[model samples]
Target chain A: MAEEKIRVLIAKPGLDGHDRGAKVVARALRDAGMEVIYTGLRQTPEMIAEAALQEDVDVVGLSILSGAHMALLPKTVQLLREKGLDHVLVVAGGIIPDEDVPKLKEAGIAEVFGPGTSTQTIVEYIRNKVAEIRRSRKNA
Target chain B: MFDKEALEKIKERQEQWEETTLQQWLARLPERDELFRNLSDMPIARLYTPADIPDFDYLEELGFPGEYPFTRGIHATMYRGRLWTMRMFSGYGSAEETNERFKYLLKHGETGLSVAFDTPTLYGYDTDDPMAEGEFGKCGVAVSSLADMEILFDGIPLDKVTTSMTINAPAAILWAMYLVVAEKRGIPWTKIGGTIQNDILKEYIAQKEFVFPPKPSMRLIVDTFEFGAKYVPKWNTISISGYHIREAGATAVQELAFTLYDGFEYVKAGIERGLDVDEFAPRLSFFFNAHNDFFEEIAKFRAARRIWAREMRNRFGAKDPRSWWLRFHTQTAGCTLTAQQPENNIVRVAIQALAAVLGGTQSLHTNSMDEALALPSELAVRIALRTQQIIAHETGVVNTIDPLGGSYYVEYLTRKMEEAAYEYFRKIDAMGGMIAAIEKGFPQKEIADAAYRYQKEIDEKKRIIVGVNEYVSDEPITIPIHKIDPEGERRHRERLARVRRERDNERVRQCLERLRNAAQDERENLMPYILDCVRAYATLGEMMKVLREVFGEYREPIII
Candidate 1:
């Protein structure tokens, strides 16, 4: 039997309509052989969390370019945890400042990707992090 | 353009020169083994000669500027008489904040005003709405009602300087509020000139800011056309834009083709509305992107004018010469800016802005260098404004009109661009027009595929973006980021609340009722009703809610 695919959900969680980055990343992840589901434009944090739960995604990627990440990203992380998805590796991208990265990670985001990040870097990070999470969950 | 005997002699001499001189140089120093591709990924030839366009008809294809088939330019004088409008697309925080920014830009030699509304305003939401959480004044100014609109334009002369608002979806509502402002100031609607980016078709295709479905959206756009033609004659009703389409990762050819087709659809819709094409077509303007490729962008602009003029005169049967002019504004590509070496973007923007000038743009906006990191700070935006100033005053490019018009390479590239765009036109025409094509996700899918291909090229080293994929840098960004005063959002919410409370709720209710009823009827022009709603101080959200109930919202088909 083939190993289970790393299930991921790519979401755009704000009123920002700049989705060139989001769509490019989604296609890259799908091509990387992960099971990807895209939540179309203008998704709220609640909508994203609901999709995360229903889709049973192992990872959640949030993209925002409207400079609302300080308020939206943390709320998304809280919603995911409230839904008992603490194990889902939450990552964010799109115009987030470098100063906000530590704060976002402290708020339970696994990583924060800035502009010009390579898809291969993202693919490798997801593969390694998901394997580590699975091993920990199995041991637990 | 050449005599037959002369052409034969030149061709024979060129073959001999290539055989002997070119071959000798190539044997000693081989050419680089790499394909030279433009932003559109089209192959660029190493050399071009008259042989490339052997049947070139100078009068037929590129007539004198300000004449028929305006491939060279729209105006005879061009930049010699007046400079292109240096309009900066700006807005941030509250109305007060953006108003200050506008005054700043005007004082610093910005010729015109361009308003960039926040996400909420673009979506027709009030600042206090829950859906607007974390989004207040982030991307642009937050305008919830006429009170906000008043504050945004306070103390600005309405007659002297023209303004351009980058608002859609609720463009009619915002436009009504603007007209009311001018009316309060006792300025005639005909005297106040501006442009509302009322291109909703592009919203569905690339921008994703569309509210209502296509049919109702097209109806709303036609309503603006009818009203604008009658009242605000100087105002541009629709700015058919390719800027966002190119920014969303389309080739220069795709941007040119899709934008012209959208313009054609609007003409058809206006004619179907029983209005004469000449009455509304003249007011239709275009917006394009000046990307990294210099010659390709210049060729795209020239080809756009030729195709639009031919279509408006022949295909649409317009008698007026004004209707045939493809007047346009251009903005340097925002997607080309990088976060790694922020300062280098100034150089990139300078090159792009020069292309817009050479391409004969009516108005231009140069992106700030620090935009890839955040909204431009005061220092960064000044540098951006000065870039245009340098091009206009310092550089002697404005002294000549279409200086590159006769270059062998430029003419060949312009002809190729026209052919490629017509090819796309044939495909879109067969899909039963843009609306049917958009419903099938035709343009959206095309843009997505192009975007992915571009990214892959950069990732795999096939394309080189300095400071992104090549010439890597590890230095930390030290530029001062533009931070919105957090108090602005609170202040705006309070202002919105006061506007709602102080206004006569009874009158607001009645106006919205009439607007809702008018919106349900397809034949009714909703601009008059929307103007009434604005007069009663009905907030943007309140008015858009009625339309949302009447026409319903549009949900885009998932394409990625």
Candidate 2:
């Protein structure tokens, strides 16, 4: 039997129209053999969470460059939790300061990637994290 | 450029040098790589000789400065007469805070003003709107109404300085607000000179900041061209831009092609609107990006001038020499800046800014070193401005016009750049111009593919970005980043609320109603109506809402 492909949702969550990073990352994930869905620009947290639920994604990658992550990223995580998708891994990227990375992780982001992060690093992180989550769920 | 006998002899000598002298060196050093490519991934030859540009003519192809085909330059004196305007793109927090920053830039020898509106303002939203949550004053200054505009330009002299506003999507509204500010200051529209980045086609192609769909957007742009030609003769109604396209990961060739093609589209639109080509085309300007590859950037700018001049005179039948001039402003590429070893970006910006000067830009903006992290701190911005000054005053490059005009490689690259851009023009023409190509997701897909390939190259170590992939850094960042005053947003919102409360609501409503009624007529120039709305203190969001109701919003096709 074939292995089950990991499903991921990549979303842009602000008004700033800097989407080069998001589009590149989305294509990278798809090329890595994952089922990737990209939510285009200006998606609110509510819209992102609802898309995450409907798509049944195992991971949600949020890209925000407008310096609104402190307000938008956590709200996206909360909405996902409110929808009872607590097991979904949430990651963030784009122009994020190092100081905000720790706080964002504490706010339920699994990881925060800054500029110049290799797509391979992200692909491997998603693969390992999703596999671990599956193992834990099986044990549960 | 060279006689046939002389060219043959030089070609033979070059071949002999490669076989004997070059072969001996290659046997020892073996070269760095089997292939050498530029930032655009175009291959570079080991050496360029007269054989590369065989058919080059001194007068026909490379005309004198300030003459036809303008390959050397648009002006005869070039930088020897006046240096390129040192315009810095800046804005953050409330109107009051940004106003202070503008004064600081101007005091520090910035020749012109370039306003960078925040994301909400870029999207045509009021500061208090729910859609603007967490976005107020993040990217630039939050200007929701003419009241904010008044404060933003409070003490700045409108007549002395030319301002460039990097606002699109809601560019017309913001421009109206600026004109109203000048009117209240008793300055005539003709005396106030500046540019509105009123290019909307790029919004769909690369920037994606579009509000309405293509047809209405083109109409609005033409409206500005007509209005500005009659009243604000000095104002550049449109700045056809490729900076965002390059930032979105297009190659140097793609940037050159898409930008010039966009210029052609605007000219066509104006002529179709019953305006002569020379009447509005002369006010049209261009904006380009100066990237890491120095020769590639210089070649792109030179080829742009040559192509624009030829096409304007031959294809569009433009009579005035001003219509053929392709005056442009340049900004150093922001995507090339790295978060790691952030100081290295200073060197990168210096090289790029020097390229812009060599390319003969009308104005230039150098990116701050710390921009990869956040908004530019005061220190970083000063360093950026100093980089341009050193290039202008210290370097002797400004002494001569088109110093690199005769180099074999530079001329060859310029010709190749023109050829590649014409190829793209043919393809876009077959696809029925830029709007149709954009709707089909052609340009967007090409940009995405280039972006993905660029990242993969960096990841696979084919490209070595110092301090990123090669010389790694573990040190924590110690540079002071510009932080938005947390109280600035609150104060801005309170000011916006006061403006809404104090302004005459009935007058605002009447103005908006007139605008809505005029928007339905295809013949009516919307700029006058928009000016009335601005005069009445109608908010940016209110004006955009009326247009949205009439024209509807544009939704882009998803392309990954």
Candidate 3:
């Protein structure tokens, strides 16, 4: 069988118009051989989760710079779970405070990448996590 | 002058380090050689020494304050005469809400007013427009009509305080609304003073808030220049900006070069429109980002003034000294804020604001501490305004002019920046002009590459950002955050409905028809018709829709 491709949805949530970092990360993931869908700026959590469901991506990456991550991210995770998408890994990256990482992780976030985290690290993390999830499912 | 024994000791220590270095390991175990330097890599050695600026003629290069090639300072007394205008960029929710915020800012010792329009307003849409749904007052103030504009500036005298509006694409129409509001208050066109962020090239490069394509957008910008030069002589028609460029993750050098290139393109556009360089150039202003690199930011500003003066005089052939001067406003970088220990942002802003003052900025906007989280709360915004006040009042840095002028590092960086910027300018010239370069995706690629490389450096720990990768905290966000009004959109739409029902429909139709006619002809300026449309209370959406039909939308080319 051909190798299954990892699908990722990169989305910007909230009103922040700054997109340089988001665009760069989206391009990096694409270059790393993943199929990445970049939903442009000013997206709401409902719209993001809906798009992720439609795209049927293996991972959903949310980029929030407007400090609404706490308010927005949990709602997105809950929606994903309510829609029976809990298996899909949820990751985020932005100007997130280090203190908020544990809280986000507790809220069912798979990983939280802060600013200055390498694109390579993210790619590697996603690849490893996806493989581990698949391996566990096969054993089960 | 070192002693022989000390020199021998140093050499021995160096040899010991070299013996354990990676080169020694590489020789022992052969490996593929990697490229040492990248095209976008900023070199550490490009930094210092008198050798880089050996031909420095102090009087000519760093002339006295208010003289040609105004690198030292724009005015003779500078802050000694009057401190830089402390203008905080403030707006949010509907017009009435933003008007209250403006009044609050002014009451809190803010010297000037700076308006931030909502996304729909920036894109020229009425609150009732379908495309403007869910986006009326989300980002900034929603000004959909002359009624909204009047409400935004309610109780504030136009002739008293100079306002700077951060709106592009629909800049001409929004500006027309401002003029109409001023006229209603018995203020003459000549008596009004303010600046419009009318730079379109940077819109394509960074902000991505553009409406029309480059050609039609350039036409509208030139129209503002012509109108302002003839009518509002004190008004700065365009604030050639680099703030958005830096915010888009460009390096200091790229920000300086790309911004000036955009400025040159605008000057070319004005001259092509038959306006004299001296006539409209004096009214031209600049806006820049004060990033974390303190010395580099200061050097960039100095080099900008010198380069603009030289190019305006030697290239554009302007005889008036005012045409050569590059007066500018500075805003601390929003990208530098951290959501981790949000309070740490206060210190960062203070340092950046000090750099801007040292760089001789004419006006300043200090970013609030809570910006990385949301739009600044009233308390946070007040603190930001106070940061500037403390700098101007407490810090003696403003006591003298160009305090850091003779520093060896600053002088070297200034000259190096000028040389590097001119090289980029020459390349852009080769690519035709700013518009051609943008269409070809040259500047966009360069900025993207620079952004990626900088991110790499930060990841590799070559660059250290406090409260982020290093010195991290485990505390929760204890600060209060600003919340957007849930009723903002509903309220805005109701106001729009009332205006639509009450305004003279026939006059609106006639005014829009005149604007449509004026837009079709290159010979007629659109400002007069825009003012007429504003007087009729025609919505921003209606006027922009007409222009949108004539000048299609601009789609950015993806070239990463």
Which regions in candidate 1 have their CA more than 4 angstroms from the true location? Answer: none
**TM-score of each predicted structure versus truth:** 0.99, 0.99, 0.87
Worst 10 residues of 1 chain B by lDDT: B32-41
Off by over 4 Å in 3: A1-3, A11-17, A31-33, A37-57, A60-121, A132-140, B1-41, B45-52
Summing lDDT over every window of 10 consecutive residues in candidate 2 chain B, give the lowest-scoring window: B38-47
- Candidate 2 per-residue lDDT, tens place, B1-560, comes to 68999999999999899999999999999988999988667789988888999888999988899998888899989998889999999999999999999999999999999999998899899988888888888889999999999999999999999999998888889999999999999999999999999899889989989999999999999999999999999999999999999999999999999999999999999999999999999899999999989999999999999999999999999999999999999999999999998999999999999999999999999999999999999999999999999999998899999999999999989998999899999999999999999999999998898999899999999988999999998998888989999999989888888888999999999999999999999989999999999998889999999999999999999898
By TM-score, is 1 or 3 better? 1
Question: Across residues B1-560, which tens digit of lDDT does each residue of candidate 1 receive?
Answer: 77788888889998998899998999999888567888777888778888888888999999999999988899999999999999999999999999999999999999999999999999998988899989999999999999999999999999989999999899999999999999989999999999999999999989989999988998999999999999999999999999999999999999999999999999999999999999999999999999999999999999999999999999999989899999999999999999999999999999999999999999999999999999999999999999999999999999989999989999999999999999999999999999998999999999999999999988998888999999998998888998888899889989988988999999999999999999888889999999999989999999999999999999999989
Q: Looking only at chain A, give the TM-score of model 3 against the true structure.
A: 0.95
Q: What C-alpha lDDT, on a 0 to 100 scale, does residue B108 get in candidate 2?
A: 95
- What C-alpha lDDT, on a 0 to 100 scale, does residue B148 get in candidate 1? 91
Every candidate's DockQ is 0.85, 0.86, 0.23
Candidate 1: residue B201 lDDT (0-100) = 91
